[model samples]
Target chain A: MIGRDEVLHVARLARLALAEEEIEPMARELSAVLEHVERIGELDLDGVQPTSHVVASSSKVDVTRALRPDEPRPCLPREVALAQAPAVSDGGFLVPSPQA
Target chain B: MSAEVLALSAAQASAAIGAGELDAGELFSFYRERAEADREAGQEGLNCFTWVAREAPGKAGTRVRETVPHWPDTVRMHESAGSSLAGVPLAVKDLFCTEDAPSQSGSRMLEGYTPPYTASAVARLREAGAPLLAKTNQDEFAMGSSTENSAFGPTLNPWDRTRVPGGSSGGSAAAVAAGLAPWALGTDTGGSIRQPASLCGVVGLKPTYGSVSRYGMIAFASSLDQAGPLTRDVTDAALMLAHMIGRDACDATSLAHPQQIALPSAERLDGVRIGVPAELEPEGSSIEDGVRRCFHRALALAEELGAQVNTDISLPHAPYGLSAYYILAPAEASSNLARFDGVRYGLRAASSSKVEGATDLLDMYTRTRHDGFGREVKRRIMLGTYALSSGYYEAYYGRAQKVRTKIAEDFATAFASVDLIATPTSPGVAFALGEKTADPWSMYLSDYFTVPMSLAGIPAISIPCGLSDEHARAGANGAEANGSGLPVGLQLAGPAFSENKLLDAAHALERAIAFDSTAAHV
Candidate 1:
């Protein structure tokens, strides 16, 4: 079960600000989701290795694809890369200062 | 007039264009008119597209020629190669980035943000000469099942305007259904494409995971996401899948080897063994009477056509798919969505006027995401952050992964005895517009039947089997009570790389049922 405090904590972790009225409702919704998902814990998965990716690899060695060769390739031009930036400054993306 | 060509399956349209029976220009006009009509029709118009291209390719000064510089090499390769998908117009779900059109992913956060490239799947479609006609709407970041989570507003069901078309690929499904375009691209992460395609009475194929490259397609759940086609029938889906699938270095998770799927040569499923999971029966789960009736009738039809239908198969862990999907998808979503910080692409909350309200940089990040994301998006993000948070990881995400493994093993075990599995794509027909919006759990449960295949990373197809009248009468509200003649989808799933086999079974079922998919109004 989740509460308003947990909701706020999670929001902080996700870097999402919640309005005052949204906190309780968000908590309620999250609690419902948790309750629904909690059913997974009832079944014992003693030796099951979790599947991170569903790549169709029949053998352990073939599961992971070889990484692409590290030859340097052409990257997106600066103007194109910055096209969608909300704030740009001196050909670089701008954000609020890291230091508070 | 446009209805004739619009009604043609993508394969038919392509062949017509290839044979010179249908000119690309006229086909484009038909699709353009239909797109404009749908856009103008407002609420009843299906409202399927987020952005409709003004002119089709081959026209002087068209968007394709104007935007070729931003397109990847594959798309540019076909620009000089003349018409190839033989000029069949393609509508794309907004989740796939098209350099010419704004790829908003049905969220206000990325409004008007045009990516510098096109999705690899879409590039292949272009390479095959499928003209881009429009960009369809979807759930915000492919989150909701009803498409109601769209900031642009929900797409009305073409079948019955009052009912939903299903989501987050609702627009793509509805567009194809209403004859706006011959076929469209849709991504499935926990049944986005299949469920909506089922509800809208079209053929939707969710290819085995990693079969199609996801490059330039906005990420929702990294591991679960796979792009496929929403078409009028099985053959068209096969054609689109054949063109769209290939290995791409841009997406590391893309398949190492290209998959080649072609139209099935056999007309009947003589030796196919179709497994009907016992847990999915109406007596056990919440499947509606109407859907159950249609499913049984389709199974009977399949049996008559030489396929063996086995109803005793038990997938004990299949029912846990929804829970596991919710946990795993959100955990990945929380991680995938972290790139949307205010500094880079997408909307930012920080502004000169809002500076007074924010305390610092942290405040900006918080406010930006909070203000940008919709209610459902925030809810999932919060849930995912909680699950992946330190100390809670093993309890939620880790356990969900194990359940995913169990579900995959269940399918593997079942497939050893049977060639394919059968179920109703959704439990019921589409509900009215606002019916289940308040209850996210109810909406999530709509995908219960289709989520298991997604977890198992298998191929599945949803095809129109029959019409259901139950939701029209004694269902939720009178809005759906008029026997809206809603279409019911029969889902057929197979093991990984079994697209040809799955499509063969689906084509057999399709020919047997002979369900008319034409919307009354369209």
Candidate 2:
């Protein structure tokens, strides 16, 4: 069972607000998810080094390469690239408002 | 062939088309007819799809112009397409963006939201010769074990109407198993692809992270997710893999090393050594007797094929694999899924419903994510946020990462001696729909044999081992083991970028077992 303060804390951590009506239901769901997480906590991992990269880091393969000198390359024409744009002004494609 | 051409595996279709036995157009129409027929049969009951595309395969501009449905339709028309892969019909997991169809990703939140660009994996397939069929259903945000978590309703397993097709790649598995398409693309994070494939008794490969490009895959658990091929046979799977891999500028984790992978042509069990983890096969774990017998039979077949099989290998840290995976998967998922904050991409709750201009962008994010994502996805977000939050971070998320490291190390220590790890892909055959829903423990346990590989970021595939005698004895309704009555799977797994070898060994078993005709759907 989760405490009232614990429920509120989970909601805040998850960046959600719960109504009084939703609190009990939300608390049950939250408790179930946390219980599983708690089950994950039973493991003992003393002196084990953490692995961030799934692929083994290699000095040869993973070395940061020097920036290549600019070479002439094929490029898509601006007009063709901009053909699908909804709006354009002053040689620039004008996109719609993300807020809208 | 009447409708048999469309149902043929990638290898079969390509071979026949190249041999002048079958035509690409015939293969296209067979699936076009079947997809239409099955949609009619399944749309009401299975809920296995979000949207069906209006266009048929073999059209121009489908690779880049259409949604990133894997293996573009246009390339199949190329005469050179008959080289490696001539024609294989494929279904896309709805999570990937497809231009012609809506990329809903199984959420009411993104209903009818078409992406502006096609994903790179889909582009690669189009460049190869495979035809893009349709988009299959998935869990909202690819979260649930059963595809029941989809906003559109659950995807029922093809074999039994009541049981689930394991998800979030449920529809992809179902489409392949029920012969809607020869193959499909599925994203696996913590056994999304493997579990569904095991339940469906089809071959699903969760390629090593970074082996395949995620340039167009919708993010669920960033650290864990990898796009892979799911097909009726390992040969078809290998051909599909050869088509959709290599480095991509759009994805940083994309493999710098892209080596040509040969499929069943390269399958060699001779001189191969296998490791069987003792923990997975331990008695009384809900793994049915049929699965165990089949696993043993597969092992014996491998041994008979001149492979050395080792049993009783103890990777003790593997015992904690599920624990580590749950923690890291949810932790990564929480952070990655925060992008759907109703600000940039997807739906936002209406301002009129808000408290008279009091709510802002943050309020909109909290409301949309809280309401939009399914219960499992939401539950994970909350649990992960709490784990990543201050005061609890060191105790939960931090320690889980440590356990994850230990699990990887344990596998490395074992793999030093053995070439690959083998287990029963699932503990048992598919279960009833509501059977495990009441208890998440059972649901998590469903992937017990498979999760360790996902946590280690290795490749794993499930090939049908044998059939369930129990289901056969009771006739039609006894158990929903699999549509083909196969209850067994030889869960083959290998370390990162070891797909070529894994596919080779899986092909060896596929031939040795000789269940291809009996096991394949339609």
Candidate 3:
């Protein structure tokens, strides 16, 4: 079973804040899922390469498709882009200072 | 007239509009009115849509036409000149970003967030004259098997409100099934589109990975993510796909579609070699008897249609697909969802705790995510983080990728002698809401039959084959039981980029099955 400290550690790594009551249940559920997925370790996969993307291995696609020219095309205007930002400064995103 | 319009398939409706039998404006209004009625109907409604547009883009009274009249006219001319879905309004899963519409992706994290641009797939469909009618709800970040993970609320099944419309594309499937929208777009990572389509008794096609550009789709599992249509029939699915596919400059992974998506009309599956993998119904497995019966019956029907049925095919690694998928998908999800940090867009929450400096930023992120994400999303993020951590990376994530390759190779070996592989789209029909939510493993098992094809990145479709023998409880609130059983879906998967042939086979099976889509009423 995955322990509370382990779950808390994972939450910190994933940058999630768990509630006081959520930790135990999260650990239990995570342990259950991990146990199920651990069965994949039984496979004799020696020397087998991992497949990150299937299209790269697909035979139908051309390997040497031409890349788009580095021409500046119409894009979302800066103001429009900044419109969705939670906190905006003068023409850019505003954030807390990095230093103490 | 309203009933007749609602009854028409998307293809038939498009043709009617072209022949002047249906007015595009009036047709759009008709669907909009029904969708609004359904949305407002309280418990009787299938809360499918997250946002419904008042008017289609480029139509009169909208800003698009007000600024550019000739542009709307040009679009109209193109529509009349025979775009596949001529002016048929479309319902999109909220994951596809639409400019100026709240594409929240069914999460509080993005509540009230509108994108500045439209998805490549949505834009292409719109260019083909299928205007945006509404944005449908989905599981938050398209993570959950059932739509219960939607932070807004679960989208109830149109067939039986007591049951879940399988998700994360449940709202798209429910919308199409209930006639809330003529057709809809849904993304399938691990059976999101097909499972929901199966549960709702509609047709869903998950095209080969990268066949349809994923430019504006909210990322879930990038390598496995694919966008496809959830329609009422195979022909309508074919029509929607024809316009949605092509290589796009914006998405490097996308490739040019090899063949045109023809509206399949073949009534026989002659010269087709179908393989039924032994892993589909292993001893003591969760495959429900009703679903298994329907699957075997569909195979029998395929044989009657002159197809060679080979039952000896074995995908030994397929049983491990669900395990590998859970690892790979969430690992990718953890990386993809890192952009949701409380900085640029979406929801931002201040930390409740007093912290100094960089810790303040960290606290803000944790608090925002904790407050923003639903339980399932949080669970996945945690699981993914654990799997990809320094020590566990090779044991979990790396091994899962190798298993994924093995599953793909299994399919390749099976496909060497078979034209198509068939399985039940899901273990069973639409399950009751909250039935599996308490057990995440059970929920994960819901994709048992559908995940292998997804792992292979092959084209697969779910078409309604028959209804289950087990009837919905009498007088399930919001929908009349009518003594009819829930819908069961038969999945047909083919090798990479075999959408045309797969559709042809599904179309043939669809006709032979003769499943009544309108049997269940909301």
Candidate 4:
């Protein structure tokens, strides 16, 4: 079973601050799903190549074909890009200092 | 007039507009009013839409010139002028970015976030003269099997108010089923579109991965996430898919769909080889009795329609699909969702005493995500992070990918003899809201029959097979009479890029089954 410390460790790795009340339940739920997922370990799949993506043989264009000329095209204007940011500085997104 | 308009399929409505029998504006308004009424019905409402566009009377077929920049210049003007859907407004899943609407993706993190440009798929559809009707709700980050994960609140099923509309595309399925919109767009990671479509008794298609461009689609699991259609019928699904597919410069994984999504006209599945995978419904499996009964009945109907039904098929690795998917999807999700930090667009947690030692950038990110994400999203993020972290990567994520390879090989082997494979879209019909919410594994199992296709990146379409027997009996007895029973979906999955063949088979089965879509309860 995945314990509370492990859950908290994963949460920290994921950059999610778990509330004091949510930790225990999160641990329980994680353990439950992990139990189900751990069944994959039962399969003896040695020398089988991993498939990260499935590109159909019948597809006319593969990943390489999706590329156009690497020329600059019209993009979201600076104002439009910054408009949705919760905190914006002069022309960029504002974030807390790393060492603050 | 309103009833007649609502009853018309999206393709029929589009044709009517072209023939001058129906005004585009009138059709749009009709659906908008129904949707609004349904939304306002309180306890009786479906609560499908996250944001409904304001009434745009005569602006139905009027092209939004601003979106033209997003469209590829080559073939844009011609396709826009002469497309199948001539100004039939579309209901979009909130996951797809639309410049005109808030694309929150059903998460508090992006509560009011709107993109500067529309998604390639939505923009293409809009260019085909299908106006944006509304942005439908979904599970937060398209995580949950049921729409209960939506921070906006769960979208109730149109057929039975107490039951869920299977999700993360629940709102799209519910909207189409309830006659709120003629059609809608949905994304499938692991049966987000098909499962919901099955539950709501609508038609959904998850096109081959990369068939429809994923540009501007909020990433869930990049390899698995595919945008597709949820419509009332196979013809409408084809119409939507025709306009939504093609190669896009913005998404590297996007590809040119090999076949034109022709409006399927096949009424008989003559000589079509269909395989019923033994892995789907082995004894002691979770397949519900009612769902299994409907599935067998659909197979029998397929035989009657002259299809060669081959029951001896084994996708041995398919049962492990759910396990692999949980690992792969969340692992990808962990990486994809890292962009949701407080620095950029979206909710930024206020630096307050609530955030313990909230001085640094790390504290801000942690606090923001904690406050922003729902329980399911956080759970997935944590799971993904754990799997991909040191010491666990090889055991969890690496092995999962190899298992995925095996599942894909299984499909390849099965497809060698059979043209298409069939399964029940889900284990059962929509369950009651909160029924499986307490058990995440049970909720994940809701996608049991549908995940393998997603894993193999093949095309699968879910069409209404019939209703669950229990619900049918209840309706018959007038205990909870609604003329319609809970929907059961029959899934037809074909080899990669076999959409044409898959749609044809589904269209044939759909015609033979003739499942009534009218939800009287809504």
For residue B453, model 2's alpha carbon misses the true position, in angstroms, by 1.1
Q: What tens-digit string does per-residue lDDT give for candidate 2 at B142-244? A: 8877787788777877666556789889998887877777788989988888888877778888887776778768888777788888888898887788777
Against the unseen true structure, what C-alpha lDDT does each candidate score? 0.82, 0.71, 0.85, 0.85
Residues B191-273, model 1: lDDT tens digits: 99999998999999999888788888899998999999998888888888877775666777766433357676667889889
Query: All candidates' TM-scores?
Result: 0.94, 0.87, 0.94, 0.95
Per-residue lDDT tens digits for candidate 3, residues B1-522, read 888998888998999998999988998998888787776764467889888887645552232311111211222211222255678999999999888788998999999998877777887788777888988989999998889999878998877788889999999999998888999999999999999999999999999987788888999999999999999999899899888887776777887767767778789999999998888753235788889889899999999999999989999999889899999999999999999987889987755323334456777788889988889889888889999999999999999988988888888899999999999999988998899999998888889888889998999999999988875543456445666678899999999889989999999999999987766544
Off by over 4 Å in 1: A57-63, B59-83, B256-259, B281-285, B350-359, B473-484
Better of 2 and 4 by lDDT: 4
The candidate that achieves the highest TM-score relative to the unseen native structure: 4
TM-score of 1: 0.94
Question: What lDDT score goes with residue B393 in model 4?
Answer: 96
In candidate 1, the second chain superimposes onto the true chain B with a TM-score of 0.93
- Write down the worst ten-residue block by lDDT for model 1 chain B: B74-83
Q: Is the docking of candidate 3 incorrect, acceptable, medium or high quality?
A: medium
Name the regions of candidate 4 deviating beyond 4 angstroms.
A56-61, B41-44, B65-82, B282-285, B352-358, B472-479
Worst 10 residues of 2 chain B by lDDT: B73-82
Query: Which residue pairs of candidate 3 clash?
Result: none
Which stretch of 10 consecutive residues in model 4 chain B shows the poorest summed lDDT? Answer: B73-82
- Residue pairs clashing in model 2 are B66-B99, B67-B98, B67-B99, B71-B125, B72-B125, B72-B126
Q: Which scores higher on TM-score, 2 or 4? A: 4
True contacts kept of each: 0.73, 0.32, 0.67, 0.77
